[model samples]
Target chain A: MASFLEFRQVTVAFGDYVAVEGVSLALAPGAFVSLVGPTGCGKSTLLNVAAGLLAPSRGEVLLEGRPLKGLNPVAGYLFQQDAILPWKTALDNVALPLVFRGVPWGEARERARVWLEKVGLGRFLRHYPHQLSGGMRKRVGLAQVLIAGPKLLLMDEPFSALDIQTRQLMENELLRLWQEDRKTVLFVTHDLEEAIALSDRVVVMSAGPRSRPIGDFPIPLPRPRDVAEIRLTPEFLRLHREIWELLRGEVLRAHAGA
Target chain B: MRGLRVRLWQAGLLLGFLLLWEWASRTGRIDPFFFSLPSAIAQRVWRWFATGEVYPHLYITTVEMLLAFALGTLLGVVFGLWLALAPAVAAVLDPYVKALNAIPRVVLAPIFTLWFGLGVLSKVALGVTLVFFVAFFNTYQGVKEVSPLVLQNARLLGAKPSHLLRHVYLPAAASWIFSSLRTSIGFAVIGAVVGEYLGSAAGLGYLIAQAEGVFDTTGVFAGMVVLMAFVLALDALVGTVERRLLVWRSKEREGGSA
Candidate 1:
């Protein structure tokens, strides 16, 4: 498969403290890939580099055979914290990307209304981010990112703050959305099960101070999955066990280093 | 019911304080010549309103206050955004900004009066000097505190510099700006009144200053009463605008009554 995004020996260092070093990875178009790592393993650093928010100290990123420069133009990022503008209502928040693109207010609003309805927030078009529950805000964030229709989706632990039940629901929602178009996804998280459940492939990073990918595991699970139900399946358990064996050592190493 | 009780108590307290003052003056418990009776003050104020002698002064003062408030807020936001976004400029001007802010701004009233001549322009300049720092500090803090994640998300969403300013930076700073509205407005009023008291020929402050010159305590007290009412009205107006603009903030976070 042709690579949609390819990182060639990317290294990021802040002064003398190296966050990640010589990490090279690639994602095929429409592939759902997750980078799983222990705490402080710099999984997020790689995602930032991919999104072109942070420049790698060395090496380069090629997006669809071209060298990526500045911010990746065709990506939508869902942050770990509430990223939706607090001053805007749900409808306006979702419409902002289109508005930035010079879409007329009336037309953007009409499109936003449709998107909100699709995200099961039709009644909440007028609600602010603060008015929504945590899970609901995540839904809005998801809708806000998806409305722009980016070819690549970069999520940095987007649902990690939610309760387990809400997290699972969001994972399923995400899977459902991705199935519709299968835009290339680069999800970064510490939760192994979550990475395994949502991703077609899981890339694990070693502990930090110069973190790099140590293991890449193919999930091989059947698609259209319910994240909760899939966890109970034998294949899923086996994959989890296998990945955890590799991941446990890195996690211990990180803990000891810290 | 609790709110009604609180309102009633507030009204009762004001009524009692007025009655005490009236009694103290009428019975000559204090020198009535200096501390004029509240009834006399009320009568004077009513007569000024009935004959329409207060209109011009009221209009001038209001114009000065509004011009100062609007101009000060606009300049504050623009400069605040500029300084915050440009780190090098902010660093270079940090000491100058601090030194300027440290000066007792009231002293500038006389200079402004001399420069602009005892007109609305002088009063507005004084008011702007007083109002600017509050708005600027709030805006600076607000813009600086904007989440890195949010900025990255907007960038990933294809926000240009202009779009980020309009949608992200401005809105992020707005909450802080709104929070400082009452404080800045109070400064504006002080600027106008002080400018008038020091030199202007008209305005409520001029009326009070003139009464003080001749020892007409009733007139001075009447001017004070009118000024109090003016400030209260402005405060109420600010509250209405804040509620309207900040509808997206949760009521609880806004610290509104339950």
Candidate 2:
């Protein structure tokens, strides 16, 4: 398949601190990719570059065949934090991008209601962010991003803030959304299991200040795989162990540097 | 029911203070000339209302307040957004703006009257000056405080600079704007009244000045009471608008719970 998104020899820096360097990757359309590493391994920074939030200092990011000059409105991003507007009702929060795009209030609200219902938050449409539980808030955040109907979705440790049970549920919810939308996804996380569970390909990065991808592994898992089933699969365990083995030394190196 | 209880307690305290004042004045323990009995003030108020003379003065003050408030808030929001979004401009003007705000606004009444004349314009100018700083600082802080994470997420979602301003910056500043509005109410009233006091042929402040000159303590107290009632009503109106606009605020959840 032709690459839909390409990062060509991308490097990112903040003043003197180089976050990512000499990182190159290409994602096919409708592909699900995850970047896994210890904290500060520049996984999120790489995602930022791909999303065009940060310009690569020494390389170019291309969406399709064109250079990505700035942020791509055709893309959606879910942060580690829910980032829901605390003053907006769940329905309004979900409808925000539409509203900004000049959809009238009545129509935007109706569309928002449909998406909120999809996330099972229809009854709590009028509830504020603080009123919802952590899981519910994350779902609302998901709905907000998905309502934009972007071609590519970028998530940075989106489930890390939730408890184990909630994280599992959210992971399943995300997988369902991915299946339904068939959008290209670039998810950044530290959890090896999560990376294996959700991604078609997992990219592991070395520790910063000039971190680059050290390994990339493709998971050959069947669709609609359950968490429990995936855990028991020898293939899943083998991929998990391999990724962990690559990450462990880098993690130790990061600690030593710190 | 809880709201009712709170109002009942407020009323009770007001009545107790009135009774104490009435007893003190009637028993010759305090001078009624300076601190008029509540009953006498109420009678004066009733006379003014029955005669329909209070409305014109009330109307004058209200118009001045509303005009000043609208103008001040508009300027504050615009300038605040400019200062926050433009770092170089903020850096160049910050100290001067702080010094201007620190000067007591009441001291500007004479200067405003001299510049704008003895008409409603002077009062509006004075009121605007008083209301402007409160709103400006709050809005500045609000815009400045927008989460870096939210901005990053929005940018990744392909939000243009204008989109970031409209969706992210403005909403983040709204809560601050609304909060500053509560204080701006008092400033609006003060501005109008002080302007009238300095030089005006009309408004509640003029009535109070006239009453004071004539030694009509009851009339003076009645004028003050009118001003107080008007302020409270205006504040309630602002509160109502805030509640409607910020319906998604967590405080609204408390309202629903109640």
Best candidate, DockQ-wise? 1
Each candidate's clash count: 0, 0
Please give the RMSD of candidate 1 to the true structure. 2.3
Residue A219 of model 2: what lDDT?
A: 86
The candidates' interface RMSDs, in order, read: 4.7, 5.4
Superposed model 1: Cα runs more than 4 Å off:
B255-258
10 residues in a row with least lDDT, candidate 2 chain B: B249-258
Could you give candidate 1's per-residue lDDT for residues B163-198 as a string of tens digits? Answer: 999888887777788877888888888988999999
- Model 1, A115-203: lDDT tens digits are 88887899999888888899988888888899999999999999999999989988998998899999999999999999999999999
Local error of candidate 2 at A86, Å?
3.2
lDDT of 2 by residue, B214-257 (tens): 99899888988988888899889989998787766575343221
Measured with C-alpha atoms, the lDDT of residue A5 in candidate 2 is: 91
lDDT of 2 by residue, A1-258 (tens): 878899999998999999999999999999999998888989988877777777899999889969998777578888888777776788888887787777888999999999988888889998888889999999998998998898989899998989999888888888887899689999999988998999899999999889999999998899986765587788999988888999999999899989
* CAPRI grade of model 1: medium
